[model samples]
Target: MSEQELIYLLALQKVPNIGDISAKKLLRTLGSAEAIFKSTKKELKLIEGFGDLKINSIHDSSYMEEAEQELLFIEKENIKVRYFEDRNYPDYLKHCIDAPILLFQNGNIDLAHKKIISIVGTRKVTTHGVAFCEQLIEELAPLNPVIVSGFAYGVDICAHKAAMTHGLQTIGCLAHGLDQIYPKAHAKYESEVMDHGGFMTDFWSGSHFDRKNFLKRNRIIAGLSEATIVIESAEKGGSLVTADIANSYNREVFAVPGRNTDQLSKGCNNLIKTQQARLLTSVADLVYVLNWDIQDQKKQQTQLFVELSTEEQFVFDTLKKLGKSEVDVLALQCKLPTFKLNPILLALELKGVVRPLPGKQFEVI
Candidate 1:
């Protein structure tokens, strides 16, 4: 879009009570933001949901002045702006009714044919929650999924770090504008995140830094990805809000189950119990529920088995036959020494043919 068109869009965005949905309605009715501004009050009032007050705001010059100033800031900072109707705008977000009319982004973000998932949870994440978040990303590294998260403490940061550690692109959806990062302490990670993936938000440079902004930001987190995963959340938190939004968008929502008594697990458990989210245990669950190329996975599994040594194959076969069995039982059934079987099992685990369970039991993946 031209600078003039963008300025008009921004001016339209500045009109109070004219949100994304209303703006889109006007745009569809008039065909363009510039045309909307040129429309007479009678024409504007003719559009559904556009009251006399909202129609009058279009004639105010202050909004255009603000848009011009914001445009200057945008140009000065060299920030990338994506119009809602532009091809470069996020495909999934574009389908959302409340998605911003314009999205401001920075860094190298490429979403083409990428499997995207949003990871969210409580700010006060537990040790186990952190470990699970990291392990989940590590296991999914092979899939090359783009991780999306709020750039907050705990699960969000952990997901971003794990994605970066696995050399995957990650997106940080911010509550505030791109001009500053919230939680000043996270500033240390800003450069690294930008280098790996980058940050995104719909807020303008001078938008307020209010608590309500984070709640509004949750929609972007939920809308950008194919699925949203809740690692851990308390009975009430922003992560749950994101999960709810994702569900509302008809996107898959996955929540990791926790012990019933754990405070942080309550929200996830409630989500699962209410059928708002699928119960997530591992990457396999996500793969199965999302129906993500099971045939390809089977082919990969066949290739992996072909590369396994005789002993490794034997252990794999034994685990497959037993479904899930203790190491002692597996070693006995395979007729291999416990010591000898351990290495074989580890190799199979690394090959993704098998997964280890608690109490030394194992199961075929």
Candidate 2:
């Protein structure tokens, strides 16, 4: 359970073709990875799946050599490493069939028993899909649910950005090792997420973003969260893999409804019609299904109106004192220029710090 021991275990785990299930089986019978490491070829042969030929591979020296640089890097970066046996390792992820033997995490990791809702879908969602995800995520974000996603483009990016806009914590499950980002475009968002109490993944430094690894990564995405939502995906999109895995794990799967004839909505409709996923049409449905504390949060929200720019404070106070009103009324009340006030209203609305009603009207909703 010590860091050094876990590192050795993870190195063994990182061995090509050697998986967590087999490693755990060996550990259960033999005790620690240290013990497993000490075991001679003949003794390893006693385990069911650890054949003599495989046992011959047990004492292989490449593990230490392959992991030397990663160990050094981890030590240098001061990254927190947790193993399967560590209490800090997420319990939900532990329940999966092949959870990582060790995770190399680099950020604020909140394992609190909050509602975790994963949003995933096509990396090439349409404009409609983007808007759908944005509004839904915007509504759900204020409740402080733990958001999870693959950190890919389109819907994944949309969910993370939307959650972040509302100051929500969002974890990204990367397909490759934690050492590198696959899609270099997401670097800045990744940094923001890490700063805002989100977490990275399990693989070692040198793991590649291979096709099979992405498939394997889907299990963690499904297992770590309370529910998975498919925002928009074509029939053959990869996001469905996460939904399927979530279902197999007896977890909830939800999908946003899209136009029937739209090809991108095909996967979502398939999930809903086949009972693979629940249809989510509004934020209320998600909050209720997830049993999030939207009402409680609203009641607790004090409307401190702190950290406001001079203009924000002016607009905010005007609305606070007055009952329901229009944006123009507030603009007149604040006496601020239209350019500045409009964007501020939008920002506040997105944060749920303020809201807008129909008919050029604005009020807290």
Candidate 3:
């Protein structure tokens, strides 16, 4: 956008009580932020949500000063800003009613033609939760989904790390401004994260750090993806809050189930029992429920020429014939011992030629 348009937008954003929804309404009515400022009081009053106070705030000169100062910061830091209505803004997030009118981003984020999933859970994650988070990302790497999470401790960081480890793009949704990283201990991961994906936030520069910011940040995590996964959470936590937001947005939510007695499992268990989320055990549950067709002809065409050993070819041919079948059934048909078949299956899986289903079933991707 032009410098004048950005200045007007920033000034409009500083207006009290003019949130994203109201701002959009005004934009639709007045045609541009510059027009909104120049329009008479009668024009502003015509918009449904613009009350006397809100309309008056738009005329305040101080807001322009604040916007100018913020503009300086944006230029100085070389920050990238996204207008909500712009084509470059996240597509899913654009549908959210409360999505920010403006968002700040840093790093190499590319969401084009990609599957995005948000993984969140309790900050005090259990060993099982960590393992599941890592394994889930590893398994999903081939499809090249963008992993998203708050850059907090435990589960969020674990999800980001796992995604990064597997060479997948991972977005860190920050609760505060991009001017600094929270949980200062995680500073070490900043450069690596920027190289792969990046951090995003609506919070402005110099905004005070507060615990409450995280609750507000949760909406971005929920809005950006087609689905949200809660690895583990206590009865009440930010991760559960994200799941709730995802449900509200009509996006799919999946929770990893645990024993009823486990403390961190309560949130996930309740979500399942209440039917707020689907139960997730492995990548298969997600693949099946989301109906993600990894067997796209384009994806398959890229791998059709992969070299395979005679044994591996036999296993692949068997899997292709049956579509998907239990390992024992495949072994019986191929006349190979199950022990020998297992290694062949593992090698195929590593080569991204096959994927395991919930039982002992396997399918060619």
Clashes of each: 0, 0, 0
Q: Judged by lDDT relative to the true structure, which candidate is superior, 1 or 3?
A: 3
Please identify which of the two predictions, 1 or 3, would achieve the higher TM-score against the true structure. Answer: 3
Model 1, TM vs. native: 0.85
Please name the candidate that would achieve the greatest lDDT relative to the true structure.
3
What lDDT, from 0 to 1, does candidate 1 have?
Answer: 0.88
Candidate order by TM-score, highest to lowest?
Answer: 3, 1, 2
* Model 2 regions lying over 4 Å from their true place: 293-299, 302-365
Tell me how candidate 3 scores on lDDT: 0.89
Q: What TM-score, computed on C-alpha atoms, does each candidate reach?
A: 0.85, 0.80, 0.87
Q: Which ten residues in a row have the lowest lDDT in candidate 2?
A: 293-302
The Cα local distance difference test for each model comes to 0.88, 0.77, 0.89
Q: Tens digit of lDDT per residue, candidate 2, span 253-301?
A: 9998778898899999999999999988766566557665444565555
- Which lDDT value does model 3 have at 65? 89
Better of 2 and 3 by TM-score: 3
RMSD of 3: 4.5
Order the candidates by lDDT, highest first: 3, 1, 2
Tens-place lDDT digits, model 1, residues 155-263: 9999999999999999999998888988899999999999999999988886888989999999999999999999989999999999999999999999999999999
lDDT of 3 by residue, 177-237 (tens): 8889989999999999999899999888888888788999999999999999999999999
